[model samples]
Target: MSELARRYALALYSVCPDEQTLEQTAHVLMDDTTLWQTLCSPAIQGQEKARVLARLPVLDGHGLLLNFYRLLAEKGRMTLLPEILEAFNEEVLRQKGMARCRLSCVRAPDAAELDKLRRALCRLHHKQDVIFEIRTDPSLLGGFTLEIEGVRYDKSVRGALSGLGRQLEERRMA
Candidate 1:
């Protein structure tokens, strides 16, 4: 959640040639265990870390991204990689006119059900598309809840019970 990380990520993303290049660089950084661990691990010496980062083969031919990695090491913000990547993804989604939605339910939805929900969300949000990040929680009781573009649609059985409880409480006071 570092503002600095968001700023740096935005700066890098703006200059990124395409989403593929940006994603590839992220994959390179994340795919190398030694390089990623060394840069983010505090157990390693700063200078040694720098040397290891400098030797990352994936960084070759990616000057801007390589410099970005070096700059983070210099500023001791290597741990911000995940945050920066998240921000960059959000930016990419925004640019593509897509929204990331969270769908929570008592059980996992089937593919057909998921597609149905996706289309409804797209129509509701008026966005080009909706990407669902689905999760299941038995505690939800039944039904599902959706969070899209900061607006939440709560339709779970648990939600209805909670509303009833609150209304009863207010009525008792009245």
Candidate 2:
């Protein structure tokens, strides 16, 4: 993220009350996949992108957030909306002392399993307020990986295989 983007995100994060609202706003901005596609389209010009962005109203935004979007659109910086939203979310999470845990599973875990995992994670992190955002990635083969903040617990089959491969290579060299 550029300094400008980070500044914008921080400004928004300061005003936004909760992650859900910020996430909703982000979803609205991201829902328009066509906008990004058009921006990347070879035939589109910068002026045209600005025009397109100008037409988009600030969804649920008041005061600062609204003004920021307008400024970005006016300056032809709309392409950075996703990045700004992501940065804003990170800032919000950090403020809440809630590290985001991204869990990718090969299949949807049962409710009981999810609860168990959540409890385990809460205990592991020693956090009274822990939040887990679960996702399913079939390509994981089996098991899953837990990403908390920047640290990763790679329990996925693919990760294990890669680790084993590395160990074998080291043994061969030694």
What lDDT tens digits, residue by residue, belong to model 1 across residues 19-38?
57667767777777876776
Stretches of candidate 1 off by over 4 Å are: 1-4, 31-34, 42-48, 110-112, 172-174
TM-score of 2: 0.67
lDDT string for model 2 (1-174, tens) is 677787878877676655676566556666768765664455666666555545656544444555555566556676687788777777776776666688899987888997798778768776545567889998878999988756789889998899999999999999
- Considering summed lDDT, which 10 consecutive residues are worst modelled in model 2? 58-67
For candidate 1, the TM-score is: 0.79
What are the runs in model 2 whose C-alpha is more than 4 Å off? 1-7, 15-61
Give the TM-score of each candidate.
0.79, 0.67
**Best candidate (score: lDDT):** 1
- The backbone clash count of each candidate, in order, is 0, 0
Q: Ten residues in a row with the worst lDDT in model 1?
A: 17-26
